[model samples]
Target chain A: MKIRTCKYFAKQSVKSIWRNKVMSLASIGSVMAALLVIGIFLILVLNVDYLAAKLESQVEIKVHLVDGLSDTIIGEIRKEIKGLSGVKDCVFVSKDKALKDFSESLGENSYLLEGLEGDNPLSDSFVVTLEDPRLAPQVTLAIKAMSNIENVVYGKEELEKLLDVTYFLRVGSLVIVAILLLISVFIISNTIKLTVYARRREIGIMKYIGATDWFVRGPFFLEGVLLGLIGSIISIGLLATGYYYIARYVEQQMFGLLVISLMPFQEVLKSLTVSLLAFGVVIGSLGSMISIRKFLKV
Target chain B: MIELVNVSKTFSDGHKALKNINIKIDNGEFVFLVGPSGAGKSTLIKLLLKEIDPDQGNIIINGKDVTKLKRREIPYLRRNIGVVFQDFRLLQEKTVYENVAFAMEVVEASPKEIRRQVPIILSLVGLSKKSNLYPSQLSGGEQQRVSLARAIVNGPSILIADEPTGNLDPDTAWEVMKSLNEINHRGTTVLMATHAKDIVDAMRKRVIAIENGTIARDDKKGGYGI
Candidate 1:
């Protein structure tokens, strides 16, 4: 297409949009609303996934050892534990170090543990980190069956609940997104259908004047894209503002209590921006294409 | 040049609009297509424009068989021919100049060329001063003249007008005819379909009259016969 022709199409599209301001506004609003719903859900799914991943990274198993085991026997037990498939690495935590950690955790009440310095009741243990957090339960059972290992401990119930929630959200989000996208396409196209119907006479005239189907459709195609672009931008602006405030509030309220913090607004900005813009353009163009097809028969 | 060889058309419900039409219009001839309601005159014009295909014949325009032309090639063929309508079909929101310029824009004519050609065509149709006025602001004759300006601005070799003056009073209709005549004088083949008996009898152009599904008369300097 020539530069002048592009200018002409742009001019025609803007003119038509302005000419039917009410319809244009309605379509734009609909697009904005649709994208906003999708955006909110998408942000939710993303943050949940991020939180689950953070928790997974921190997960490990504490394998308690039988007391008074010889150093060589402890070495043999470590070797056996290391041989397991899911075990990434294990660090020996001596009873004295465990006692020190417990005292430190007591903070201002550390004086209560002053008499236990020489004789710590904490068991010797191996802090076991795995290659994958999902293997924690199976790895724990294997370690418990090994000789010299008295017990194995992990946050099995919490991990299972978190994984289940993430999986459910992911599948649910996919279904919601698909449905929302279809509805947006329908609404945007219907809005564009009215515009095309209004100017059908002009289209017929252009056809008789030898205008190619593309030529006749150029302005309308551009109209849809413009509407989509405008809608997406507005939605993005509104969503970002709402998200920023919510993120700040969550951060202040939860502080260090949350195992995985809500993702910072800036962290998700680029992806959200790119996805929303792309979504708007694709939906907008597709809507116009579908709407204009029936009228181009002339 | 336009030629229809043994062309025929039947609607889906079995209405035969044209039967074995064989028309050969030479280049630069001014012709009139006359008929009463449902006499197949509109169908014949549509066939010539390649708007509807003849069920069992060939339509040759400028020596190319339009019936065999691919769908993508139809626009290029149409670019070589201009068309006007009884309704004047101007974009109501556009000013007179933009309405004419739209034709050139459709063909992707260069901006400089559009800027040059549009004014000349507008002046030729005597709409130079009214170029800024919208269609609704113009009189019927003036609107028709604007349509005339648009039809010829692309310099098509053939010009087809379907009831170009249908909505106008006789005097206003004559003003539009004068513009059509002026366009014809510039060497465009003009084929107009209409029911106006007086204009036909006075113009003395080559007349092809259709009754029912066939040509009833093809007269050199024909009148609107009873």
Candidate 2:
């Protein structure tokens, strides 16, 4: 590009938007709406994933030792559980300790079991927390096969359901976001197409006077980019301001109850601003090119 | 200078437009391409502008083979040539100044150049007082004049007007023709295609008449004679 001419065309593009005020405004409005939807969804997805991951990290599995388990055999099980890939922490709970836990869990029935814990009716067990809950089932099954492990209790159904939900959340969010992004692109492009249709005569005149493809296209494409950039900025601002009240309310209402942290302002800001700006500029230009291409053939 | 050598064009529906046509126009000459309807005049002009390509032939402009010019380079070639269509072709949304300034902007003229050149060109087309007027606010003659100003403002080495007077009254048509003649006198090669007998005869410039897409007559100082 001849820098001066490129700048001139850039300025003209900006002017064209103002000159065709109604259409330009419509285009900007549609793009902003599209990007806003996308930006909000992106932030929501990121926060949900963060929260699910935090909760998943705290769940654990219990492995019961076999009847008549030897001290050396118990040591071996500890070494084996500790060596398991995702095992974050492993501790052997003695049979007496297990009985005490059972009794305590019984509440009013604890009195009925008061003398039983000394007899150690409960078998020894290992408390195992894995780095990832999704991997817990496979590792727990392996521990159940060990010589000293008689039974395993990790709420298998519950763990599976939690992992399935996380997988679904991650996959479903991505698919929905992808579909919405495609919709956003279509909306942005169609809006630009309408603007181009309105300016068809101007394009013909421009070509008749010797403007090259890029020259003729520069202003419209720049208009697309400018619209996109501005739309992104607008959406980011709205999202940031809106989410502030939402996060504040959520934090206050569920202060001590929430198992996961509320989304931070910075993370939301990053997702909102980055995605919208990218959506605006890239989609805007592509839309402009598709719209203007038919006329530019002249 | 523009030259066509054995250029032929056939539409996809199998309609032949230009057939083995050959013509040469020197720099600074004002010439009319005259013919009846279906005589290939508009097709020939479209070919020259690279809006349509010849199926079998070469087009040389300033000694370069325009047929071989890249798709992107077609508009660059246009910069050295100005075209005024029969439709007036003024950008309806912009003021007269904006419409005229658009030409320079597409080619990326500096703000300084735009500021200096646009007013002069608009004035040359008798539109100085109406710089802020849109095409909707102007008469048919005035709109065509704006298109003229836009075409010529860059001072192209060649100017092409394809039936510029097609929709004007005699007086307005004469005014548009007069603008073309003045630009021609300034040494820009002028190639105009018209079926208007009165305007053609009145100008008394070299005339190339076509029949069935081939040049039938090339008259020095011709007067709309077939």
| Per-model root-mean-square deviation over C-alphas | 3.7, 5.3
Native contacts matched by each model: 0.73, 0.86
TM-score of chain B of each: 0.98, 0.96
DockQ of 2: 0.64
The prediction achieving the highest lDDT against the true structure is 1
TM-score of each: 0.87, 0.76
For model 1 the local lDDT of residue B201 reads 96
| Model 2 agreement with the true structure over B1-226: per-residue lDDT tens digits | 9999999999998888889998989999999999898889989888888878899999999988988989878877888889888888776777999988888877778879999999988777788999998899988888888888888888889999988999988989988887888788889999999989988898889999998878899998999985
Question: What is the DockQ (computed on Cα atoms) for candidate 1?
Answer: 0.74
lDDT value, residue A148 of candidate 2:
61
Query: What TM-score would candidate 1 get against the native?
Result: 0.87
lDDT of each: 0.87, 0.80
| Superposed model 1: Cα runs more than 4 Å off | A67-124, A129-146, A154-161
CA lDDT, candidate 1, residue B75: 85
DockQ of each: 0.74, 0.64
